[model samples]
Target: MGVQLKSSSLSPTVDHILDSRRHNSCLTLDAVPKFACRVKYLNLLLLSAMPGCCFCEGMALSRLLLLVLVAELAAASSDVGFVFDGFTGEANLSLNGYAEVTSEGLLKLTNFTPEMTGHAFYPSPINFKNATDGRPISFSTTFVFAIVPVYPNMSGHGIAFALAPSKELPGSMPSQYLGLFSKSDNGQASNHVVAVELDTVKSVDFADINANHVGIDVNDLKSVNASPVAYFDSREGVLKSLQLISGEPMQVWVDYDGGEMKLGVMVAPLNKPKPQVPLVSFTINLSSIVLDEMYVGMSAATGAATGCHYILGWSFGLNRDAPPLDLSKLPKLPRQGSPTKRSTEVLAIELTLAAIILLLISTAAVILIIRRRKKFAEMHEDWELEYGPHRFSYKDLYRATKGFDEQNLLGVGGFGRVYKGVLPTSKMEIAVKKISHDSKQGMREFISEIVSMGRLRHRNLVQLLGYCRRQGELLLVYDYITNGSLDR
Candidate 1:
């Protein structure tokens, strides 16, 4: 029988298409990388023939690339497990019934209500990979889950990780049945469902040893093998039973080999090195339950008293040769009282208002800069008009200094050197102090002399004559002081 992998976005019905040929189905989460698929070539060939179904690029492009990895399942062993990204959201799973992963990260299989039933299935099916002739294949599965009470009160019913003949759990009901079988199929011999039950409440409807126990169900409510869920503490050398509705996530490890199954429960505190001693060990022929390839997932329900059931994290491996699971690698537990969808709305409004305030501040800064530039230009225009007659042309000064010849230079001081030169237009002898271009003090002194001396009238002090500007040099001129201080 050829298994053609299908592309159904989030449909467990990807297995539903084993009955059809040349059909389309979406890929599974981990199944995207395995199985040397010849079916991919077939899918491409079929799409080429049908012009109406051209896959275009857009949001669907990413789906197409992932879907590209879909291929036929080979006749080989199947090993499926979950990563940290497994319980991210509803986006990562193919949920059914009322089952969903809440935004707070809880994988709620069924809400708390009377007669509520929910079934969640992983998108892919597990193959025992032993032989098709009904040979018992040994496998192991580790599950960390919780059964919460409806506040101040515990609930009836429980949850189970099931290996079913098909994806459908037909005739399933709530309570003692645990939503795996119905009243009609309760005691029936032909039911191919093998469930490992974590039951909380006792039921008159079924033979339950206690309110809290782990059971192995084969087509019936009566457990073929059962044990009260307990942890064996090595330090104290005692086995302790746990309250199933304690709200803390409990870890259960199951390993089956050599016609015998072993289960370990760690309820108090789970640490490195799995509990060595098995809490429950029983021998049964899983070969009898194996009628076909099984779909492995969790099923939960509520009846009478209801509590929120969660399948936080789970992993499975086939055969004894596979590597042991590192519980640390499993996805994180759902956080308690995390922000819900309603809180996200409030956050969105706050973000929008902050963005508007930032935009207003940026606009005001740009306007202020432009206004300051305009005011500075108006002040410079007034300064030029007031000092018009006193400022000599740069050309007249350059000619009078003869490109600042050496003989015309008289003396040098902190600011610059004084040069004696005669103006060509009026034959007026002038002493010029050429301020250094890069000197900060020289520029300050030049501005101080202009603003202070130009407005002052003095007879004893040297008269302020004029000034000139070259490329960037500040040239200051004053009546030559010769007879009073120098030997002329």
Candidate 2:
């Protein structure tokens, strides 16, 4: 008959397309298998088109695409590295990581000086070059190192982290290698290298022996060489002269914020949990090197009499492609307290003195007013003695002036109004002077006119016959003179 087949023993391809079943009919089997296979392939195509339907599958595909994108991005960014070669050409290697030169192989690096040598690590005999054509590499590198002696009396040379274009190693490295130190015939100093030096060598010019320090060299090779653009010992402890004995590891960190071109340095002891003791710190403008490529590496050398130095481990990180550093993380200083209680008391005393002055002025004003009133009253009484009181009451005075009518007014004076009237008692024409209550001069003028007129009895002069004072009003009676005052 036809080929015998068990449902459980179906081929993988066929099983994938069709469910378990056993049948001997060839026509049914062929048609069913064909339909099942077509359906399975169609479902796969639909799933691929509608990716959301397969959540897990879609996520996996997305992640793979993301990884590829990130890799492409990183490759496109600037490349950072370290160079180690003779001081003649550019260094071919680009290195980034933790770097150190230790006494007992504690921190080791690729290019390190052998032990028991009086020379420093990364001896100047070994020059590292960094070369990039047009693209500038932005990176931060640190050097952590310690000196170790072959014998108890032996000391090692100093080292430097240098940025240089040449590959030719210097001939005469100083006692500490003083990284980049070289003598010149000009006596001005060798102007070849730029370096940040960590010097351990003792000098009388420096403050102390165990002093730690950091310095920036521009166009100079010797440690003591003078330069205008260099900053040594600053408030931030960048080029401190404090020394660290052999076998003690010191750590330094240099950071450059790309936007500001500011380079910052921080130093600390390797064993401490906190960065309490800072060895070096500073900021440099990197705008000039924005387009220039630089080699990031360490360099050291031994003098004619001394041996080679040792460099243990070395590494660096390129932050040129990384995000900008946040300035808010820096520490803030404490605010000072307010002035002391003694100062506050002094201020209070000054204020009290001013208040006393003001009080004295007010009291003087009041005394002046009282004295003026007393004088006015005495003058009025004197006028009454000379001119005598007006025999007429207030009613008579008002009637005589026609209830002080405007039509009866003779003229206006600075003090009050003068009105022409006929007194009923004397049946004689006269002038009634009404002094304004609001005028201080009106009161004085009334007293003066009455007193002066009452003293004289001359025909040519105006006669002051009587006067009335009541309810803040003053009335003066005088024989009516046909002519006005001489001044008028």
Candidate 3:
């Protein structure tokens, strides 16, 4: 993780204090800091469970530490910044806003089914440290998505990458808000919603500029900077406008530079560069509007004119010369939503239980390995076998049957398989009754065999030479018992 980023919903009170156009809004925070602090601390439990075992876990602590520091820094200096790349659930990532992994390798957001509203955000908070008080850090994000109309050639609303202070919006209108603003906050200046709207349907009320145009929304829905959706055609060294809801995977880039506090977007994949001219460019300062930290993620909605919103992949880079947005390197689309959701506290509990189970399993494994020695009866030096009835060594018996290979298998019994093996010392052939691990009645049968054979001393019947038991693998050594029980 290059830096920590946060994404979430807003409370009514905090929004009022930060909601102003003046360079200063007389802003003060009590709950934001407390919430940020609590969030940062809860994340540490993740590190305790994951002890850097694999590629994913190796960077868990450092990335979480960056989040913790940014949360603290937001309390000290109002400036904060964070970056997220891909929604593939690495680095303690979870779904926040309104999205779920749908189907095998597919991230279906918004309306995967009918009558649905969806907003998905990264669990982390995004805070950019700016050079000036009113300026924001230069940030860029690239998201790959596909918009499929519920009915062919018909789609409503679209998606946006938003920076807000909270993870949820209560009762937000589904049609116009794009699931971005709540019912009380819609059309209100105090909304604190900054987004690059990808409008697909023309609206007189929203002043969409036109259908399929990219527009930057400030505190409200109207676009301060709007442009027809287009992509850089590097092959022709030119620009071309394209329909956003064309039912194909499309890429959109959002870049904000601190020099002028301007934001830019491009509609092309990683193969194409950020064009010299932006699809939409507007000037503004996040420092003036954004709270101490903001949640950054994608939001999409489908109303009566519905479409299925999908996020194939996503990434973000904040502050200090972050790398160019690359869509090629992302993993496959989501297979299914997280078994548990993190926006709620349930995710932490799930991970905690899984970690505990893992620890218990590992401890049991360690104990078993220590106790696994003396596998062969001959390997047990202190055990007496010479006085017994021609006791056989485990390893010698194993070799006589080629490590209990299937070819030497004589027949299948209720408890286990009987394999043909020749005694090493006596050169006498034998049928070994082996108790398998998966046999449901194996333990009961093994006890019966041991008891029944121990009491008998008949020579005419198959003599019980000896028995071996170690780590669930039980074998009864007897005289050449029932040779060739099965032909093949």
Clashes of 2: 49
Q: Which structure among the candidates has the greatest TM-score?
A: 1
Local accuracy of candidate 3 as per-residue lDDT tens digits, 267-378:
8743466566677788887777787667786678776788767776666666543344345544443322321122234656778999999999999998777655444433
Show where candidate 3 strays beyond 4 Å: 1-86, 89-98, 112-115, 129-134, 321-326, 329-488
Candidate 2 C-alpha lDDT tens digits along 331-364: 1111111222334567789999999999999999
Task: TM-score for candidate 2, please give it.
Answer: 0.34
Please give the lDDT score at residue 473 for candidate 1: 68
Candidate 1 displacement at residue 205 in angstroms: 2.9
Pairwise lDDT winner, candidates 1 and 2: 1
RMSD to the native, candidate 3? 26.3
Per-residue lDDT of 305-409 in model 1, one digit per residue for the tens? 887787666565665432434445444444543223223556678889999999999998888888755432221234455577777765566567775788988
Candidate 1: misplaced stretches above 4 Å?
1-86, 90-92, 258-273, 320-488
Ordered from best to worst TM-score, the candidate numbers read: 1, 3, 2
Model 3 residue 58 lDDT score: 40
